[model samples]
Target: MPRAKRFYIPGCVWHITHRCHKKEFLLKFARDRNRWLDLLFRAKQKYGLEVLNYIVTSNHIHLLVSDNGNRDTIPKSMQLIAGQTAQEYNIRKKRRGAYWEDRYHATAIQVDTHLASCLIYIDMNMVRTGVVSHPSEWRWSGYNEIQNPKKRYAILNYRRLMELLGCESLDALKEVHGQWIEDSLKKGKPAREKKWSRGIAVGSREYIENIQTKLGVKAIHRKIHESKDSSELREDQSPYTAIFGTENERLRQENTYRWGLF
Candidate 1:
């Protein structure tokens, strides 16, 4: 399902999930995945996107990033990466139609502990799918890049990531990252979390409410949900239904409209 109207508050971290059109295996090949990462690197160089973490799966991708106080950066970077990757793949394979599903969905995240959880959540995506036993096995993930920073062509903004995570240095961050993954695995199998993908905002009560306020009218009918450890603000009503006020907007219109009112 789609999220709440893509309302992004600057300086907030976001968990972005984008699937291939119709959930197809368009990026089933390694080269395609690598190309997608290549474009991500270009986005880093071009737009200064403060990437924190990412994972490219066969059918979709999970990208974690901070808005960095610039509203256009995230959208521009995503367009560059998604558009170029899709164009190149289509040209090479001679395919047609849409590449991605509508647009990517983003969830606002609170910094510190909540942000750490999102990072681990993105890391465990492949593991949850049974593609590999551990996130480390998935080379395309930010997991690999975090553990072993590239000498050249790096996509992540280490300084921003460190500041957001409250880490003193890269070593400290890496250690903490590894430990969190280990703890999650030991606790048992990880599952697909909807808050990261579908919710409007995921964090503490105050943080989520702040996001909702920033959204203003878009947050209408959206309510805050609390669990044992965290809180999320989500809309019970579908965005389509909220806008059109009907389960099926098409059905509400006369059949004569199929051939025009004339």
Candidate 2:
């Protein structure tokens, strides 16, 4: 089947995730993880990609970045990072095959509450997976760098992050960011559901509809009844999901848990 079209609106934050081929632990080692981070750092400098948050897990990676509306910036940055990482890994292992499963999945996030929620989600990924009790303990994530004022990782754009959070100062941004993560931890980790990734876009009803119209997708309404009254579903479902709903059922049936080393 043809791939679904990806819509990139200038000045929008995107939550991107990509998995290793066959779900293998390609990034299980610390050196490999560090290499990925180094490559990302270079990509940021070269492409002007503004990375707000990120986490590198054993077999996958989550990156929250904002494009300056260049259209090619995000794609080119991903290409440089992913390609270099894969090539280095292949040379080290002396093997030839695809490193990534497919193209990275990018979901446009609403810049307000949804953006904050997505940032927290990325920060708590290691905690959610039971790999680390706290985000600070995870060296492969942005949590530590963001929390420690002295530690600086050039990959993260602190000014832009603060701007998004509506904070007036770096101290305020750090305090609020730390509190956000702590509060999320207190609430317990959320289910690693596909809502963040599977949707065409994530935000309020109006936000999704706006993007849908921009993408020229036909808007349709489905009815739901509670008791004797009928209500209309206002949210726009993913175009991919709407057309391939059955695939999700198959994925659910095959669900299994696998534990890995930190």
Which one wins on TM-score?
Answer: 1
* Tens-digit per-residue lDDT, 1-262, candidate 2: 4554354555568889989999999999999999999999998889898999999999999999976757788888889988999999999999899999887878777888778888888988988889888899998887776887544456788888888879888789889889998888888865684656655567766666665454433223322212221111233444545643443333322221111111
- As for candidate 2, its clashing pairs are none
lDDT of 2: 0.74
Cα lDDT tens digits for candidate 1, 1-262: 5433454466678899999999999999999999999889889888888899999999999999887666778888889989998999899989899999888877888986889999999999888888788999999999988888776778888888889888999899899889999999997779777888888789998888777666555556778999888999876676544553333333323210111010
TM-scores, one per candidate: 0.88, 0.82
Model 1, residue pairs in steric clash = none
Candidate 1, superposed: residue stretches over 4 Å from native: 1-4, 236-262
Q: Candidate 1, TM-score vs. the true structure?
A: 0.88
Model 1 residue 79 lDDT score? 91
- Superposed Cα deviation of residue 257, candidate 1 (Å): 34
Q: What 10-residue stretch in candidate 2 is worst by lDDT?
A: 253-262
